[model samples]
Target chain A: MTFRRDRVAALAVAALTAGLLAGCSDDEPDATPTGDGPSASATGTPSPSETAPVDRSREVVDGAAPLEEIGTTTGASGSSFRGATFTFYRLDASPTSTLLVWTMTGGGGSNPQDANYLSWELYPRMVVDDTEYRVLTYSRQGEDDTEVPGAVSNPVLRLTDGTESSPQSALFPPLPDDVDEVELKSPWFDNLTLPVSRPG
Target chain B: MRTAAATLAALALTATPTVAGATEAPPLPTVEDVPVLAQTWVGNVNDDRLAVLSVHGLRRIDGGTVLYYSMGTPQDALGDRATFSAYGNGNTYVFPQGTNTLCAAAAVDAEQGLAYGALAASTPTGCLSTGIVDFATTAEDPERAPVAHVVLAEVPDDVDVVDVFVASQLVQGVPVEDGPLEPTVEEAAPAVGTGWPSVDAAEVAEADDSRSVFDLQSRVKDLSEDVTTTQDGEQQELDLDASVLFATDEARLTSRARSVIADAAEQIEAAGTSGTITVTGHTDSNASDSYNLDLSQRRARAVGRALEQRLPDGITVRTEGKGEAEPIADNGTAEGRALNRRVTITLPS
Candidate 1:
């Protein structure tokens, strides 16, 4: 089994898009991600103080999908789960089931509750071979009732497929013997490929 | 193993076990003799590589480890600022930034002018801030950022260092690192986590470090390099070059000197109360020792008396005349000499 993760920024896909736009010049304003998220704004950029030059190799020129580098877009799975960047990790296959992991992040949130609200909205889909498998799963990140000033979680969303299960469907088996990898898809993120290995 | 498991089984059968009773026992999250390290690099606004907001988690398991990070900051880069980030059990979490009036911790996190502070929503740090950036972590989204600081992850078996990360920048707990690993029977057996360390001592050291960060950025600079304040613990060190505070050898307060001193007084008051204020005057080693000492003492007394009038009650303002004894800068060059000839104020800790 072969699985190649897209080593994108550990930030939210939305922030990557915004960072893509701002990548043109390291001259980004001190504008924060918390306000509204990834602005394609002429907003003042951060001080080019110690910033390295934009590594164009990381840039997705010609309008292709974003790469692991900044300015690259996550691959699409023909669903709402397209155009976001993430690090595809984990493919745990058991005698009875499999688990897939992917995490998405964003720039700073405008408010403290934004990341929690975002986490609640994130979920993943399981695709085995060419068929889409249905299994209920939860986002890896969450929030609690908090009241502190100036807290920033580069807003992260962790994706996993470990806890999901399929009913008695032979065609859509949870851990088919011949299947090599399963694509983890989300409406809010891109499709990440992961190879499956049975638990020891 | 059977004894403990039997005890737990009995307890669970007798009454509802607390949620923590069912921790991922050792076999499931196997502990390793060798710890894991998560490398991180925080960059200046212009040259950062990763968009890591803060550390979410860091731990060592039988297989691979968990390394999590908070994803974003309000600004572009994280350089030389207080950061609200935490790491535990191989996970790293970045908290929210900015002064949150609506937050219960806002007053505390933004009071006392602590240089840098981070509170994970999961862990409540009884800290207050009054500096450039201040924040606490919420378990979930809408991360707020007030200051900036960064740390690359490393070794988790040393839970002390990990705890330091938590006390300095973490709120509570940490993120979990979940990656592709071939699950082994080795991890399924119950195991206890390593003995943790005292976070209280780490908190004190972390507080001092936070104060220094806050102090460097807290000064009022009418002229870029002339007047500045740095803090260590409860002591606020105000440095004003004698040239800027006086005319050559004159000790009478200059207009600029008075302004800077007045601002320092305000900041001193804001930090805390009922502390001693030490006013020490210094001069370049150009004159006789006796002459310089007398002059320095007179200058120190002058500043002390002036502060005595401005400062509120409870703060005991005193004078120390260290003439040519302590040279912060070189006395050879004109610039260094100017720096050496200055009035120093040390606010009580």
Candidate 2:
């Protein structure tokens, strides 16, 4: 009986040793790289590309330059609102319609809804067939339509001050009759371009 | 015991047909279908300020009809063993207790809608203290904006789970003096030195900043006639860019513009001659002229109040507004409309 019990104890001790060795082996750190370099996780970073701009300038398309050449201004004008400049162009017809295309700079970053206000303000104007009209302005994918999902860029506006009487109603004029070729002001107006078609 | 046994046998017999019917049709997986291989618990809460309830679980298998796991933890102990499955565009989780499958589907739909609607996250895991999470699209790309929020709470035995709540909306705004208003535009007049020239009461007609006053006479140094010939004894153009704010319309300044105002304050002080400055507010054509005018004045006063709190000694500020009648930009485009919205500061001009 004593011999049998001693043999049983020896077997149990051997089994315990084997189990310990197996557990330790399982815990050894993995040698192979676990993460997929770029392919591993599904999460992707924000795309790094320039956002597309709304074409509002006039020099590059069909038809002659919309207006006669005007002079240019540079340098700080010393007025309260300085660093301002203007270009002049005359329409063949008596321009009843006028559009103001201007740009503003120096604001920091912008909110998701109003990205156009982020850096610069582009205000443009045009006149066709004597009736003034204002261009509708909006950011890419913003409230005023032009909804591009992930775009982050300022908008260029083509305004026509259509007559509706009061300041409140000035923007409610009928759309412009027809848009002639767009004109461009150098430097500032470099990339700000817009395709002018017959107003809808 | 015999009656109990009989009832059990009857129940099993009744359940067998439904189980068999569910298995009769072979399930197929399509591109739109997600194949889940594990059990999941779906969790949701009807009210924000309460503990989220973990619904029952579902057994998901590739090419297999989903099944609700009848066996689960108790309602009081849902956290002990929870499971989750991925389907549709997001995750569906399982609770300790048996949950209604329909409820789980509804919860998932709600989560995804809320996540994408306001541009939030679709997943709940790895939440920030703010409870927001980020999710990836099917193309393995992250979403445009952070989509969802998850919060964890511990309730004592006596507390009701329904009482715990969480906030789901996030708003960003900066305090501004008044709502947007149209600016007035008038011809520019000659000025003395760098300051505006003394004006004749008869000629003063305040205009918004809408039409920029461009005069050839002003640009040309004495080339043509005098910039302002004494036409009828006296003349002054107020050319005031004034607007109003109402108590009801607490126009919040855009986050960016608020910083611009702060910078303006600094620049004004740097220009010297500081004692008291004036801030004016304005309103658009949205209210009665008289009421709008009053509101504009009040809003200007409010701007003064805000400036007083932020500005230092040496400058005392005054506030006022002119509503409706005066406008600069045509209140049409968002840009022009925003341009109309403003708080103007005059430093001894």
Candidate 3:
């Protein structure tokens, strides 16, 4: 079935309406996906560097929904299950102090009719600026218990501000602190171009 | 007598069953062949294409003359799923839910890297479960990747039944030291100490700068146009020329950029570790430092975007704009300015 394109466009338009946002030019000595590919001549046995890219593509395809634009205003303020509701929040941070804060919320029982399956992910992408940086991602659903998988929902991207820097974690790797903007996509939302600042 | 013969043929057709229990004794390998399952790709947990059912890893049916197996990689999972095509007795085969992790682990075999194993969630039986092992039938199409099929003498009870869930890039796993990235290499080089005839170990050691003999030859070819070695231990350099493209007013890649980018991607794939490409952009002295900086950024981004879109994701494409800082030739001459306003791409060591 088709989703509303306007909703998706509106979010990005709203973000642009709010403010400006922005990685690295390739000529830099350190910026490349290295220490990644596997050694080629070892043996016939498969290696990780040889297999990482293939696996990465499979993950994107498996989680990816059909590329159709859609509107998503109602879920931004509605309830997820009859009890817990979803909300959208924002933050601005600096490059140090490490006091980075991020917020994620949604409403109306994430019941998309088109979903054949469900999943939560901590996907990461870099804006490619030259600034050195790191980012961390996790769920706070059940913070009291360390062993349990948190109940928090999916799709999180946190940027470092001038004072508070991003942290390194399994999900988000090192990225350029000079990222102008961040865009994240999942079955969870129509568009993920949300700016950290509100519109004037 | 003819009627009796016809009766005997009918009996032969109706004699056996098409499926068997997991505990049942496996059929004799020499007399009748069985199917083997192979992994083609591994992906995330919520993949639907991965969910679409196919032939399970193990197959055993009493008196059945057929066997089936399948395998593939992540790039093949364009739509989120891969395949396990098999032939012969296409009937029910038991799939151990827990053993699926074994397939996941296989994709992330330590030699490959953690990224492969990292994608898969923890399986119930723990890591290193004996994955599916049986050589039943080969896949139908050559395009359908070869399944890692190993014919087993007997079907084991605790067989791993993982399907190829995700797919990553299917880059040829040839070593960078093997040959030139611009010209693909497929010759099976003898590994060190194999001592095979005509495969000299001393030849590999002679090229000290390169990681292997294969790499030395590739680097020598890349550095010189018509590279040749002599007993004098001295080498001569030849003229090496390559081409780049630019727009009329700007340094941005034009429509014709695809061919150049395609050629670069081929080179990157062939280069192996050298696939990591660093693209540096420059501009003429016509614009302000600030404007030229921005312009060069745009041009480099354009190249980076084009390379990422055209080449396999494994090839790292990095872009930087030197503005008017570094000039190949003097910006005074139109010919020199044209050379200055260019993007130089370098493959990593």
Sort order, lDDT high to low: 1, 3, 2
Model 3: residues >4 Å from true position, as ranges? A1-200, B1-244
Model 3 DockQ reads 0.02
Cα lDDT of model 2 by residue, A105-196, tens digit: 21122111121222122223232333222222111222233221110111211111211000000011122334443333222322222323
The RMSD (Cα, Å) of candidate 3 is: 26.3
Q: Which lDDT tens digits does candidate 2 get at residues B23-52?
A: 111111111111111111111111001111
Would you list the rank order by TM-score, best first? 1, 2, 3
- Taken over the whole model, the C-alpha lDDT of each candidate is 0.34, 0.24, 0.26
Q: Could you tell me how far off, in angstroms, the CA of residue B349 lies in candidate 2 after the best superposition?
A: 2.5
Taking the tens digit of each residue's C-alpha lDDT, what string does model 1 give over B141-212? 222222221211122232322211221121222322322111111111101111111112222233322211
Best-to-worst DockQ order: 1, 3, 2
i-RMS, every candidate? 28.2, 36.7, 26.5
Q: Identify the leading candidate in terms of TM-score.
A: 1
